[model samples]
Target: MKGIVMEVYEDKVIVLAKDGSFLEVNRDNRDLDIGQEIEVDDNNKKIRGRIIKRLASIAAAFILLITTGYGVYGYYTPYGYINVDINPSVEIAYNLYNRVIDLKGLNEDGNILISKIKNYRNRTIENVINEVIDTAVEQAYVRPEQENVILITITEKKDKVDDEKIYKLVDSHIKQKIENTEVILIEGDNNIYKRAREDKISPGKLMLIEKAIDLNKDIKFEEVAKKPVKEIMRMIKEAKREKEKKEERKKLEKKTEKEMDKIEEMKFNKSRKAKGKKEDKLEREEIEKFRKDKTKKDEEEKEIEVDKIEKYKEKDQRRYLKKKSQDEFEEQRKEKQENLIINDNKKNQDNKYKVDKSEKKNKSKRGHENEYKHNKKERGKDED
Candidate 1:
């Protein structure tokens, strides 16, 4: 059946068929737009339809709807298209709600992405596209380490999603995949051509180079792309110099800190040595004082012992002098007594001689005999 689109809404659409019957249909196809013809197919009164883009003749639509006896108009949300061509070429049509309404894999290489794309139906386009690219990377269709070129075509939508938003969405999705893959992005649009004209650079090279610059800010898009390798090397050398300077500064700081620590350690050692020396000096002083005290005490003891010995000698000398005096006096007295006895005997003999000498020779003889006898008696008394 065929119908002319009459009314459109967010979720459904109304179509006026040739039988003058108004039909409502669920909108599931993304390609359907306003002011378009459609063909409805009925299987057991269940209706499904697709928009016919090339069919613009209203009379032909009426004749087809009359013959089929039933017709419906299908509504689909207006959205943009994202065409990704790696080794695999896939077209994804999404709605304003970011839903994947249509998907097509144009080549045999697309099987990797196609198999995974179904899992993201009616999901956000960014999420679904990210999953698809990830799947492609996993399957090695898009090599991760090598230079993989991606061509993105975005159909601009008004009052819904802008060109910038779509471009960023596509770029983010592709970047989220193939972490080690170096990507070269080629944008197909008048915007890329305009930038190319303004920079006086080729559009193809400009877009890819700009993308490279966006990915790595180190590459000055305007400066290094057209310059020789020598200039690029110079730029890299300058960056290396900056990095070296930072490292040198850090090394210098560490060296300074180390030097300070060494100085502090030396000072501590010096202080400890000084303190040890002071302690040693005090110990030496204490030892010297003790020695002095001991020596003084010994000298005092020696002096005391000498004084005691001198007193004992003086007492012994006095005792010996007294004994000698007594012995000398007694000897003197005995000598005198013996002298006196001798003198007395001499006196007595003188007195007796004077009496006897005169009176007789005869009497003298007798007296001589008597004198001898008296001498004998005196000898006996002396002996006794």
Candidate 2:
């Protein structure tokens, strides 16, 4: 079977022959899609499948060593001669496309539209040529999962994806593929002058981080949106900075509110003390007036007792009543006068104390208000 292959696990082995209708023989893996014959020891101890090995076999010589048709006949195939070098199957496909489409003629307007279409078809599969180059490279470094190199040629003039957008798209999608295989890219044009140099990329182990692009295919942004490592790390740093800033702002606001509350409490305390002092003053004043009225009434009673002494004509009665009046009036008046003086002094002391405390309280309250203002300014500065 020319194209028969059996895949075990992830490796594909070419099935080349059948022995005794039950056992099988196969060409050793070479990673190329083309088929060739190989010779092995009678007991399968020795296997030969390399390029030189194929030269010893007649069947391999027919496929790779000899050319008997109007196909590539030289190692130095020229710029316009790649299609001639391709395998017969691809050659037949190209001929069919040419016959069915007449891709080389011109119209009445002398426009070379057919020529352009032929060019398009040719460039569409240019990577088949690059595959040859990749195989040459892979000879030394046969990548795991078989990394592939494709050569693509673009037409001279036609519609294509935007170049910059294509770069961004491709760089994001091709990062995930078979292990150890990093696909290589190269592009050229009709004169076959290369436009873009080759890019060899390694696959990502975590998530697919390479950009993969498909020409003339529709794909979405998220499907290929892996940010470069540098970009992602930069974003993380920026997020941390923003979070720190927010936390600092909240602290500033909290400190400012705390200071404001302290100032408010000081103001309240100062006003409450001032109000209490006023009430105390009023109460003292009422006490003074009541004491004075009671003292005046007691003096009138003392004068009446003096008249009783004079009206008692007898010496004994006069002496006894005089003694009573003197003792009672003197003692009572002395006590009342002492009480009045003490109460007046107490009122004066209370007023003085209140005045001193009020001054200190007002000063303290003003200091608290100023402190709050300073704190507010500091908080604002911090936020800025």
TM-score of every candidate? 0.29, 0.18
What RMSD does each model have against the real structure?
30.4, 40.6
Candidate 2 structure, TM-score to reference: 0.18
Candidate 2 lDDT, 1-384, residue by residue in tens: 222222212333333333411113443443323222233234432224463244335344433532444333421122221211101101101221111111221112112222212212222222233333233233432334543322112222323323344333333333332234233222334333221112111112011222222211242324333333233223444555766788999999999999999999999888767878787788789899899998988988988888777676467787989999999999999999999999999999999999999999999999999999999999999999
Model 1 score (lDDT): 0.61
Candidate 1 — which residues are off by over 4 angstroms? 1-78, 157-159, 162-177, 180-384
lDDT of 1 by residue, 1-384 (tens): 775555567776655555645566556753334433555544213223443332324435644543453332111443555666555666677765555667776556665568764334444566556666777777777665665555554543544445566557656766776554333334455676456447654344455565455544677776655642223334555666776898999999999999999999999889778878778799799999999999999999999999999999889889988888988899999989988998899889887776666546668788899999999999999999
- Model-by-model lDDT, in order? 0.61, 0.39
* Model 1 per-residue lDDT at 224: 54
Model 1, position 138: C-alpha lDDT score: 79
